[model samples]
Target: MFHHRERRARTPAHETALDCLEAGITAALPKEVVSSTVDLDGKTFAVGDAAYDLDEYDRLLVLGGGKASGGFAAALADRLGSRLDGGAVVTTNVDTAAAGPIDVREGDHPTPTERNVQATAEILERAGSATGETLVLAIVTGGASALWCAPATDLTLSDLQRTTDALLASGASIDEINAVRKHCSAIKGGQLARAAAPATVVTLAISDVVGDDPSVIGSGPTVPDASTFGDALAVLDRYDIRDSVPESVVDRLERGADGELAETPDENDPAVAENEGDWHCLANGRTAIDAARDVARERGYEPLVLSSRLGGEASEVGRVHAGVAAEIAAGGDPVERPAIVLSGGEVTVTVDGDGTGGPNQELALATALELADTGTDAILASVDTDGIDGPTDAAGAIVDRESIPPDESETARRALAENDVYDALDDRSALLRTGYTGTNVNDLRVLVVPAAD
Candidate 1:
């Protein structure tokens, strides 16, 4: 992810899923992916399992947004160099050093801002000017929602702020949030690609969503979308949050969903493809899981990937992971001593009261408290590779038997109540702060159960 930079290997839980996420993240990085992924399955940089020639394209253009968009674009520039024309990209953890010929712009997460609106327009304009020979290389990674923000016309930035805060607090899923995002933006929902008609576009994505659907990752700037404004409204209504959203925002979506506005183009639509744009997923949840599996086996631990499609409340996911740890500590149904349980997926936060922790930190805190087995030693950690989880400063938190507080009593409940697990972990010196890992592979959780009883 860092292009051979010397960031220290953190004392993360030496579990499979975490290892895999780290590796999968490493593998898809522009530097590593271009180098190692060549000739895989007897193909090179193919689309839909068919390798394509890289030399035929006149100039490679990099344009995309997400948490890792900057890093991926930089890596592509390094490998493809003078072959790359210029383009635009947005990310949360953009490396200033890697900001090459591409326009690197930063934006907010979980919420859209005025700055995002400005940057997004530039992206659309750049895409609009592409040619038939243009090889548009898109780098889509996690944290694209906040990084690639563009609220609807009728709504103000204030509306986006409130609606986003409400939706996030309402416990909505990532899919639901993105559904709303696709409808409200000009650049998202394939508009960015629509602007680049007649250009040969190649989208290189790192999937942070549960399913690696092109339309869902960073709102599918190049891919056709199937969701409608009505679907987005249903999400809001289902959460009993219709009134909470801005009036103008609701009206626009209502109009769009009612068929008054054209739905996002489908691949079968005549307007696209001849638009000559194609997208490929460079990395995803499965990629992270695979990486962890290899590392677990090498470490002499029986590795198990719980699941990469984890969602719902962050605390609930933690409970489930904790249950697995308990079973292993007690009866050992799945595996015996020295086991690693790793999971990769974007978890949701159902904001009820108030909490200062993101899903990852919440997951770590919840898991630490749940696994109260006496005869077992397990080190559990949860982290977002992009360095920001929800609205917190630390990437995530770590919890081991030794790391647990002597009086983990009062603070745990209060932490959940106030959404301040980050502060709690901060007090305990268990917060994992990596600044930025230079890549976004979504959330990673590591549960390490050592054989030493």
Candidate 2:
């Protein structure tokens, strides 16, 4: 039997899956990951194998924004207390109180509002004004693309707003969205590092993007970017987004892409070629997936990591994962019965209608309906690391066959069609609300396939 109802009470298997996902997200944001990856061992900030003596640096200034910004910043404040003078960071929902020198600024997310812009500006200014004697520590995490929105000189906020909406609706990948963002922003794609030149800039980052490309995470304000306006235009054209986007956005792209366009710096760009600041990736998909594996092991379930960098449309991804779970229960291609399947990485939704949802919730609903057979029990939970997903209050959804109503297949299809996965799951109490976990290791998904009785 493939489809069976599950009790609402937390099963041993359920609790174990949750704990593993939580541990993975938590482990990815700790100081050990940050300090080690960024090469900020003790006082020395290493670039490649060479370490720079930072004894001359007077104060450590922490700055940046993201979903995991607050958690990562808090860890840094605790670990590097006293050395940190005063720096600002913004996150969706995090307890940010600096007992010492760190200054925490709470802000909105998922979309760039005026308030989020204001709070993030203070961080950018503080980092930009760093003296040669100061160590400007940039704690970057996911959701930073929306949390930290500062448009470039050529692009106005209104222009950016319109463009961002179009891109999100177009179901473009994060990399595609960020290509336009790097061109539109004043503090992305190494521009922030360029602004903080002559000072030591240490970027402590968490990778939410596939392949852990620094330039794609939070648009990589501290990392050198290889993408260009032309690249962005290609994306717009690929998604037929040119006509839908704002007029100014098109003008800027045309101006910037043509040889008349001020070119995005080439690989041998003078800014990075001359400046000496460094970047590091603290954690990523592996961190969360690995945690899920350990949790599955402890719970006496065989753990199968499907893939850490899962991608494509949110609902489509769910169907594929559902197919995999079914395989484990029936075919057992990778592992046998009583297995827990885990995956990490971001999934996106195309806003086809005015629906409230996130990728994870869409994933859950799709999986639930697809696996609605009998005799077997399956549970799928997908949640965003930062908490909020899409326009909904919940990050994502969790559902077994029992969670769905009798009209589930039709309802699920409708919700998926309108990009309203969160609401569809909301009625069933399937939405998982953590209200911001303080860290953004991207998206974590757990697919449980119980052993046949």
Give all TM-scores, in the order shown: 0.88, 0.91
What digit string (tens of lDDT, one per residue) describes model 1 on residues 325-407? 87787777588867888787888777765657788888887777776434246777687866678787777766765555547
RMSD list, candidates in order: 3.9, 3.7
RMSD of 1: 3.9
For all candidates in order, the CA lDDT equals 0.71, 0.75
TM-score of 2: 0.91
Clashes of each: 11, 6
Count of backbone collisions in candidate 1? 11
Candidate 2 per-residue lDDT, tens place, 177-263, comes to 999988888888777777777677777678788898878888877767889889989999999989998888888888888866665
Give the residue spans of candidate 2 off by over 4 A.
1-8, 30-52, 274-277, 373-376
